[model samples]
Target: MTTLPTTIKRLVNHGPEDYRLETAALPQPGERELLVKIGACGICASDFHCYHGAPMFWGNETFPRYVKTPVVAGHEFYGEVVAAGPGAEEHFGVAPGDRAIAEQIVPCDKCRFCRSGQYWMCEKHDIYGFQAQDADGGMADYMLFKPTSRVHKIPQSLSLEECALIEPFACSVHAVNRASIEFNDVVVLAGAGTLGLGMVQAIRLKTPKKLIVIDTMPHRLALAKQLGADEVLNALDEDVVARVKAMTEGYGCDVYIEATGNPAAVNQGLQMVRKLGRFVEFSVFSRETSVDWSIIGDRKELDIRGAHLGPGCYETVIDLFHRGLMTAEGIVTHKFSLDNWQEAFKTFGTPEAVKVLLVPEAE
Candidate 1:
C-alpha cells in the first residue's frame, strides 16, 4: 500500500475568478468510516455557484471569512475503498480495492427526520462537498466515507468513469418518480442540457404519449430528440407556449418539467401546465425571483414540486446503467484530468458540451 500522505490534490475556490489547483491534507478516517481513493468526480453546476460565490451558500452567515479563502469543492464522485475502519468493514461488506459511490450527504441517523426516512431533511446533515470540516471531499485523492452514509457497490460490468454520472442520473430518476408520470402521459420538458436529457431518458421508460422538448439551443434540442423526445421546439425561433399548446390541442401538457434554472422558464412552466397538471422544478435557482402564484394556485391548480437531489435512487440508477437501460457515454461529452479542472468547468458552460467530467488522478 502507498503510504498515506498528509496532503491531497484539490481544486480550491477562493472567490469569483479565483479558482486554483492545490494540495490539501487527507482527512483521518473515524472509527466507523473508511478511506476512499477517488477515481472520478463529476463537476456539478452547484460547484460553479460556490466557486463564484453567486448564490451565497447555506451557511454563508456562519463562516464569513472562509468564503473569500480557498474552499475545497466537488460532490458527484466514485471511489475505491483503500482502507476501512473497524465497523465499516462489517457494514458495507467491502474492503480495499472495492469500488463504491459515496452519498453526498451523510445523514445523522439519530435525528427524527433521518429516523423517519427523510434523511435529506436531517438538520445535522454533513454534505460531502460542503459542510463537513474534517470530511474533505472528492477533489482530493482520498476522502473519508462515514459508516452511516449511503455507499453502494458499483456493478462489475460498469466502469468507474460511468459511476461518476450515476448521481445525476439518480437525480433524474427521483424527479420523474416523484412526478408520477404514467404511460402515454403527454409531457413537455424545458431545457436540453444534462438534467434535461437525462429526464428524457427516464420519461421514455414510462412510454409517454408524446414527449415535446423545448430548448433555445439547437444542439441540445437535437440531443433531446436522440434521447426519445417525440418533438423538439426551438424556444428562440418558435413561440414555445403557443407551439406546446398547439401540439397538445390547446389542453397543454399533462406534465411540465422546468429543468433550466431561468426564472422566465419557471413562469413558462406555469403557463404550459394544464389545469390540475404537475410542474416539477428539477433545477436549482440560487437567486430569489418573482412568479405568478395566483395563476398557479387558482387558475391552474398545478402540483409543483422541488427536487433537490436523489435521496435513494442511486442504486436503481446504477442498476439501470449496467443493464443498458441508461446510457452514460452519450451524456458525457467531455473528459479532463483533475489537473485540468478549469478546462472541464469551462467546457461544462459551453454550448457544445453536455456533461463534463473530471477524471481522478488514481484512474
Candidate 2:
C-alpha cells in the first residue's frame, strides 16, 4: 500500500470572516480502530458556530470544550474502510473495501454514563471533527474510528448522497427517543429545516394525532407538508403558539420539539406544550439565551428533555432512509462539491437551501 500524505485539508478559523482550509497532518489509527477515507461530509450549523467562536456548548469554557482554532469542522459523513487495525475488523464487521459511516462521539466505557448506556454523557467524551482526539475528521480525506465509537456499514440501495444525511437523521432519531411520542399524540415541531424535517419523519412512524411544523419561510413550510406534516404554520403570518393551541383544542400539543436553534422559538415551544407534556430541545442555540422558567417548570410541569448526538440510532436511521421511509430530497434542494464549499455555506444562509450538502470528492 502507498504511504498516505502527512497533511490533509482542514478548515481553520483565525477570526471572524477569516476561515482557512489548511493542510493538516493525517492521524494514525489505534488498536480496535479502523481508518476511513472520507467520501462526503455534511456542513452542519455547528460548523458555522465554530467558525464564529460562538457560545455553543462545544465552545463553552466552563465545560472542557473541544472546539478550538485550526481544527477540522464536520461530523456528518460517509466513507470507505481503508485500513482496519488489529481487532477492528472483527469488532466493526468491516473490511478494507466496505462503505461505512463514523459515529461522532466515543465515550469512555468506564464512565457511569456509559455503564448506564447514556454514553453521550461520558465525562471524558470527545467530539469528532471538532477536536483531534484520535482522528483527523471527515472534512479531510480520512478519519479514524475506534470499535467502541459507533460505526455502521452503508446499505447498497441508498445512494452515497442519501447516506450523507444519516448523521443528522440519527440526531432526529435521538430527539424522537427523548420525546417518546406515543401513537396519535399531537406533536408541534418548531422548524422545517434539516433537523426539523428529520423530526417530521420520525414522528410519522408513531402515527401522531397531528404533526404541526412551523417556520418563517413558506417554501420550507411547504416542504414540511410534503414530508408528512399534518399542518404547517408560517410564523411570519400567524402566532405559532396560538395556532398550535388552536390545533390541540387549547390543550396545546402533547409534545413540542424545538429544532430551530432560536432562543425565542425555545420559549415559544415551552409555551405551546400541554400540561405534563414533553418538550425536546434538539436545536443548537447560537448562544446562551434566556427563557421563561415558570412556563417551563411550574405552570406546565413540563418534562424538558435534551437530545444530542446519536448513540445507537445511526444504523436505524440509515435503514429508514434506505427503505425510502425518510427523505430530504425536498429539503436537500441544493448541492455543492468540496471545491464550492464556500458557496454551499452561503446558500445555507438563504431560505432557498433547506439542507445544503457538501459533496466532497463525490463522483
Candidate 3:
C-alpha cells in the first residue's frame, strides 16, 4: 500500500458559492470500506444548483433542505483504490491499484425504500458529497467509500473521463429505461447537454422510429446527431413544438424526455407529447418548474414519470463503454485541476461546454 498522507487537499463547501480549497486529515479504510486516490470527478448540474443556493439544496419555506452544510460537494466521480478494508476486497471486487466507482447514494439498508430494493429513493436519502460525514465527495486527493456503498469495478481500458462519465451515463440509461419506448414510437429529447446527448444514444439503441434532439447550441445538436439523433432541432431558430407536431402528422411525439433544467421545457413537453403519451423528466432544477396540471389531466392524460439516480444500470453502462457503444468525446469538453474548482464549476453547462471534469492529480 502507498504511504498515506496525514493531511490531504479538499474543497469543503461552506454554504452558497463558498467552497474553500484547504487541507484536511486523510481518511482510512475501515471494515468493508475503501480508501481511494481521487482520479477524476465530474461536476454535475446539481453542484451548480447547490453553488447558487437553490432551495432544494439550501431549503426554503416549502422545500426541506437537502445539502448539509460544511460538506464536500460532488457526486459524479470515480477513483483508484489505494487500500481496501477487511471484507471489502470481496465485496467491491477490487484491491489496491484497482479502479472503482460507487453509486451516489449510501443506502441505510433498513429504510422502507431501501428494503424494497428501491434504494435510490432511500428515506434517509444520504447521497455522497452532500452529507460530508456520511459520504464525502471525490473533489479531493483522497476519499473514503462507506461500507454501505454499492460498489462497481471500473475497467482499466476506459479513459479517465469515460470512467468519470459512467455516473451520468448510468443516469441517462435509467431515464431512457423509464420511457419504456416502443420500436415505432417517436421520441423527443429536450436539451443536448451531457445527459440529453447520452439519452440520444441510449434511446437510439431501442430503435425508436425517429429521435429528435433539441438544443440552442449548434455544436451540441451536431454532436447529438453523431451520437444517434435522427433529427436535430435548433430551438433558437425554430418552433420546437410546431416542428415536432408537423413531423408526427399532428399527433405529437410518442415519448418526450426532458433533460433540460429549464422550466420552459416542462410546458413545451406537455404541448408536444401526444395524448396518453409518455413524459419522462430527469433534470435537477434550482428553481420551481410550474406547468398547467389540467394539460396532464383534462387535456392530454399524459403519463408523467420522474427519473432519479442511476439504479441497476451502472454495470450495463460500463460494458457499453468497453465495447465502444458509448463515447465521452463531445460530452466531456473541459478539465480543470482540482485546485481550480471554481473555474471548473463556472465553465460547466456553458454553451461551449457539455461536461466539465476536475482532475485531482492535475496540479
- For 20-111, candidate 2 gives per-residue lDDT tens digits of 67765676677888888777787788876666666563445655456644456677878888888888988988888889987777677788
Put down candidate 3 lDDT per residue, 71-169, tens digits, no spaces.
877888899899888999998788889899999999999999999999999999899989968878988888999998999999889998789899999
Please give each candidate's TM-score. Answer: 0.92, 0.91, 0.98
TM-score head-to-head 1 vs 2, winner? 1
lDDT of 3 at 325: 88
Candidate 3 residue runs with Cα over 4 Å from true position: none
Supply the global lDDT for candidate 1: 0.79
Lowest-sum lDDT 10-residue window in model 2: 56-65
User: Can you give the lDDT of residue 199 in candidate 1?
Assistant: 86
**Evaluation by TM-score, superior candidate among 2 and 3:** 3
Give per-residue CA lDDT, model 1, range 215-308, as digits (tens): 8888888888888999999878978898888878898999988888777888888888899999988876656668978988888888888886
- Winner on TM-score between 1 and 3 is 3
